[model samples]
Target: MAVALLVALTAWAFIFYVNMIDEVHDSIDDGLDNSKLLIIHQANLDSTVLAKQSFDEGNYAIRKIEGHHALNHYDVYKDTLMYMENEDDLEPVRLLTTVFEASENEFYQLKVISSMVEEDDLIEDLFYSLLWLYLILIVTILAINTVVLRSMWKPFFKFLNHLSEFKLGKNEQVQLLKSNVAEFKLLNKVIADVLESNIRSFHNQKQLIENASHELQTPLAIALNKLQLLAENPELSEEVVNEVFQTIETLQRLTRLNKSLLLLSKIENKQFLNEETIDFNDLIKSLLLDFKELIEFKELEVIFKKEDDLKVKMNPELARILITNLIKNAIRHNFNKGKIELLITNSSFQISNSGSDKELDSTKVFQRFQKESTDQSSTGLGLAIAKSIVDISGYRIEYAYSNSMHQFTVKFD
Candidate 1:
C-alpha cells in the first residue's frame, strides 16, 4: 500500500510542479508584454528614449534599426543574466526583444527585462512540501487502520483466547463468547458441538475399558487357580499336565493384555499427573537386578555402562513402567546367548540387544499388537505402552537397527 501511494503521489507532484513552473513563466511574460507596449509608446512620444542603445537607469532599452532588420521578425522572450550594480552579483532576468515602429519607415528594436524567478529554489521548496505530505499521509493512514482493525477483530481474538484454555475430558465446560460477525458465530457453534461430542465419547470409552478390565479379572484369576491345581495333581498324566500348563500360559497372556490396555488408556488420558525427579541410572540398576535370573537363563551377555546419571522430572510410576517395558521387550525378542547393552547418559537411556538379522518395521514398531518376532509367549503390547508413556510425559523414544542389534533410545526432556 505504501509503495502504491508513493507512486501515485510522485506522479501527481511531477505534474503539479510542471504546471506551477509553466504558470509562473506565463505570469512573468504577461508583465513583460505589457511593459513592452508602454515602452514603445514612450519611444514614439519622446525621440530621446529611442536614442538610448543600452539600459543605464530603467529596465528598458530602445535602438533604431533598418527596415530590412525588422522584416520577418517576431517578438521573442528568453532568460538571461545581468549584473546588479547595488548587489555586485549576477542576477537572473527575463528578456523580451521585439521590433516596433517608432515612426513611418523607422524601426526600433525594444528590449524589456524583468526579474526572473529562481526555479532551483522553487523545486527544493516543492520537494520538501511533498515529502512532508507523503509522510503525514502514511502516518495518518497507519494510525486509523490500527484502531479500526483492532476494534474489528476484537471478538475473534477473544474467542481464540477462550478456546486455548479449554481441556478435553477434564469436565471443564467451554465458554463461547458472543460475536456480531456471522462467520465467527457459526464457527463458535460448530466447534462447541464438536468438542462436546468428543468429550462425551471420551468418557464413554474410558468407562468401557475400565469396566471390561475389572469384570474379566475375577474370572481370569479363578481359571488360573483351577488350572494351577490341575497341573499340581499327582494323578494327572504328563501330556495332560502339559496341556493344562499351556492353557494357564494363554490365560496369563490374556491377563497381561488386559492390564496393558488399561495402562495405555490411563496414559493417553493423562491420569498419571504426579511428577517427581527420578534418577534413571538407579532405576535401570534395580530393574536389571529383578531380571537377573531371566538374563542368566538366556545366557545373555549384559553390559551396563553409566557414563552419567540421567535425572528427569516425570511421573515415577510411568518412568518405572517405561524403562521396564523396554527391558522386557529387549529380553523377550533376543536370541539365545545374545548380548544386551544398556547405556545411560545425562539426557537419555538406550538399550540395544541382539535379535533377528532383519530390521523390524519402524513405522509399526510402536503400534498395538504389532508382533515382529516368533515369540508366542510375547504379548506384543510392551513397546506400544512404552511409546504411550513417553508421549504423555513429553519425552522422545526412537528405534534403530544396526550391526544386528535392535536399539531403543529414550530421551528425557
Candidate 2:
C-alpha cells in the first residue's frame, strides 16, 4: 500500500505539471495573435509605415523584413532566456514570432514575449499542497483500518486462551464460543462439539476401570486364602502341593497387574490433584532405603550423587510413584552384580544403571504390558505408570542408553 501511494503521488504530480505548463503556453499564444492584429490596425488608422523598433516595456518587437524572406510567413513560438536590467540575470520567457503584410510589397515580423517565472512559482506551490493532501488522506485511512482489524480479531485470541487452559476433569462445563463472524462462529462450534464428546468418553472409560478393579479385589483375596489352606494340608500329595503353589503365584501376579492397571488409569484420569512441596533428594533416598533388601539380593552397587537440593511441587503420591518406578526399574533391569548411579540436581533426577549392550525400544517403553525381556516378575506396567504420573504433573521424562547403562531422566519444571 505504501508503494502504491508513492506511485500515485508521482503520476499525479507529473500530469498536473504538464497540464499547467500547456495552459500557460496557450494563454501566451492567444495574446501574441491579438497583438499582431492590433499593430496592423493602428498602422492603417494613422496611414504610417511600420518601423523596426522594440517597445520600451521590453515586451514586444516589430522588425521590417525583406519581402523575399517574408514569403514563407510561418508563425512559430519558442521558450528562451532574456536579460532583464533590474534583475541583472537571464530569465525564462515565451517568445512568439509572426509575420504580416503591413503595406504593398512590404512585410512586418512581430515578436511577443512573456516572463515564465510567475508560472513556475504558482506550479511549485500547487504541487506541494496536493502532495500534502494526498499523504494525509492515505495515513488517516491506514490508521483507521488498523484499529478496526484489531477489534475484529479479538474473539479469536480469546478462544485461543481458553483452549490453552482447558484440562480433563476440570469441573467447569465447556464454554460456548460466541462471535458474530461466520467463520469464527463455525470454528467455535466444531471445537465445542469435539471436546464434549471426548469428555463423555473419558468419564465412561474411567468408571468401567474403577468398577472392574474394585470388584476383582475381593475374589482375588479369597482365592489366595483358599490356595494357602490347600498348601498347609498334610494329606495332599507332593505334586498337588507344588501345583497349588504355582497357581497361587499366578494369582498373585494377577493381583499386582490389577493394582498397576488401576493406578495407571487413575493417573491418566487426573484423579490425584494434591500438591505439596517435596525435597526430591530426600524422597529418592527414602525410596532407595525401601528397596535396600532387593538391591542387596541383586548384589548391585548403588551410588547417589547430589549437586543441589532438588525441591519440586507435585502430588505426594505421584511424586513418590515416579521416583519409585524409576529406581525399581533400574534395579530390575540391571546386569547381575552391576552398578546403579543416581544423580540429583536443582531441577532434575536421573538414574543410570548397567544393562544390556542394546538400547531399549523407546517408542514401546511407556506402553502398558511392554517389556524389554521376558522378566516374569514384572507386570511390565512400571514405566507406563511412571510416565502417566509425569505427564499429569506437567513434567518431562526421557530415556536413553549409553555407556552400557540404561538411563531414565525426569525434569521438573
Best by TM-score: 2
lDDT of 2: 0.84
Q: Model 1 lDDT vs. the true structure?
A: 0.86
lDDT by residue for model 1 (1-413), tens: 65686678778767877787787778889999999988888877888888778877999888878999999789998889988888788888888999998789999888999877465467568778877886787778778877887887887788688777666655358777576778878888899889878888878887887798789988999999999988999999999999999999999999988888888988898767668999888888999999999999999999998898899999999999998999998899998899999999899999999988999888999999999877777878899999999988888999999888999999885
lDDT of candidate 2 over 1-413, digit per residue (tens):
55676677768767876787788789877877787777668766654435537745657777788998898778899989998878888988888888877778877787878787886687678778777876786778668766877788777777678777776666436565567888887887788788888888878887888798879988999999999998999999999999999999899999999999899888887777668999998898899999999999999999999999999989899899888998889998887799999999899999999977888889888988888877787999999999889888888999898888889999985
Model 1 misplaced stretches (Cα beyond 4 Å): 1-166, 170-191, 229-238, 269-276
Least well predicted 10-residue stretch by lDDT in candidate 1: 165-174
Off by over 4 Å in 2: 1-116, 174-184, 215-222, 265-278, 313-315, 357-368, 391-395
TM-score of each: 0.68, 0.71
